[model samples]
Target: MYKAHFGLREQPFGITPDTSFFFACPSYQEALNTLLIAVRNGEGFIKITGEVGVGKTLLCRKFMTTLGDEFVTAYIPNPFLEPRALMFALADELEVSLEKDVDQHQLLKSINHRLLVLARAGKRVVLCLDEAQAMPLDTLEALRLLTNLETEKRKLLQIVMFGQPELNHKLQQEAIRQLNQRITFHYHLGPLNKDDMEFYVSHRLSIAGYTGGRLFGSSAIQAMYASSGGVPRLVNILSHKALMLAYGEGKHEITARHVRAAARDTGAARNKIWFLGWLAAAALITVGTSIGWAYFK
Candidate 1:
């Protein structure tokens, strides 16, 4: 809604995991670099963990998109499947046709054959799983079996798991320790710092076609850093609502007041959580009344 007033080409703060809007702050760059290195070395399994809204999904998409021609990537956005379902998902991703009555043993054999064919063609296959913390315990064990398909020198499949902090606890279980031990590269994707948060906002605005200088005031940036604690997704949520407040006021720049009002209306800062969900009903009413009064007056 504020794009026209701000001369932006699109919404700068959408929550979708769009790789095109990726802002390579230090943590994101480091995580991406680590994943790339791990894949290149043919690591059997790699893990990237972060708190919610820290941009793991976006990083995963960007990593897959940027892979070189020698790589073939399969993305599994959902990880709550059973071991059999997991195998079927992989087989589907690899374009391995399956008969209606094919059992688990036959299915796995089909997948192994596909991996070998791709390896012979000089292409490395990488499987990426998002929300891996929810994967069934048995299914995780199944993944270790899949990784065992290898040539003499390297693994046939490289796996990368993107999950929240709970994935670490899940990996610690006795049944899954083998899979955990196979993780040769691991990185914790943390939130942004103040400087990176500010830079992130500017970078996204510029990408959205905003040529207007300094759309967010220094005080506004300070408020955002405090309210969002340098999380990219929270920053986007707050900045977006604050911009709407400013737009309603016919103002061109954001201020601390706008940030506070936006925080009160957002479930993120209001509930002491990171960016998530919509504002509570009462908070919504209050902010709506306040914004209406200010705008109309």
Candidate 2:
């Protein structure tokens, strides 16, 4: 709604995982580098975990885009399915044609054949599964078995799992201990810190065609950091809302009041500000009561 008013060609604070607006903060950059190195080493399994709305999905997409032509990628956005169904999803991603009512044996055979073909063609196959924590135990085991297809040199397929921190706990389960052990490289994505938060907002705004000076005031950025805890998703939600509020009042630059108002309008961002406000109020009340008692005494 405020795109034109803000001189932005597009909305800057969109929640969608657009690589163009990606901010290469230290944490995200390191995570991406870890993935590149692991995949290049022909690691069988790699894992990346982060909190909710910490930009895991965006990182996954950015990683795929950076691969060279020698890499063949299959992406499973949702892996919450049975073993056979998950296999079918992989087969579909790899363009492996299958007949109706294919049995488990034939399905596995088809996937193995596809992997072998890709290997022979001088291409490496990488399967990226997003939200992998929700994957069924049997499905995860099936994933481990799929990596067994290899030549004398290296494995025919590589797997990259991106999920929330619960995926780490899930991997620790005895049922999946073997898979966990196979994870040769792992990286945990963290939210941006205070310094990174400032650059992150500017980065997105610039990417969205904001050619002017700082759109978010210093106090506004502080309020955003306070409400978002430096989480990218929450920052985006608050920034977008703050922009709308500013535009509503025909204001050009966003202020702390705009950010706080936006945070109050958002469910996730609202909690942090409310707790901080409550703490501040309680502190003031305690100081006032103590001073009053001292004077009376």
Q: Best TM-score goes to which candidate?
A: 2
lDDT of 1 by residue, 1-297 (tens): 889999999999988888889998878998999999999988889999999999999999999998999999998999899999899899999999889999878998899999999999999999999999999899999999999899997889999999999999999999889898999899999999999999999999988899988999999999999999988889989999999999999999999999989988988766774323344666788999999999999
lDDT of 2: 0.93
Index of the highest-lDDT prediction: 2
Error of 1 at 89 (Å): 0.6
Candidate 2's TM-score: 0.92
**Residues 1-297, candidate 2, lDDT per residue (tens digit)?**
888898889998889899998788888899999999999999999999999999999999999999999999999999999998999999999999998999999998998998989898999999999999999899999999999999999999999999999899888999988999999999988889999999999999999999998788899989989889999999999998899899999999999999999988999855666887999999999999999999999
Q: Candidate 2: misplaced stretches above 4 Å?
A: 272-297
Q: Candidate 1: where are CA atoms >4 Å away?
A: 273-297
* Local error of candidate 1 at residue 110 (angstroms): 0.3
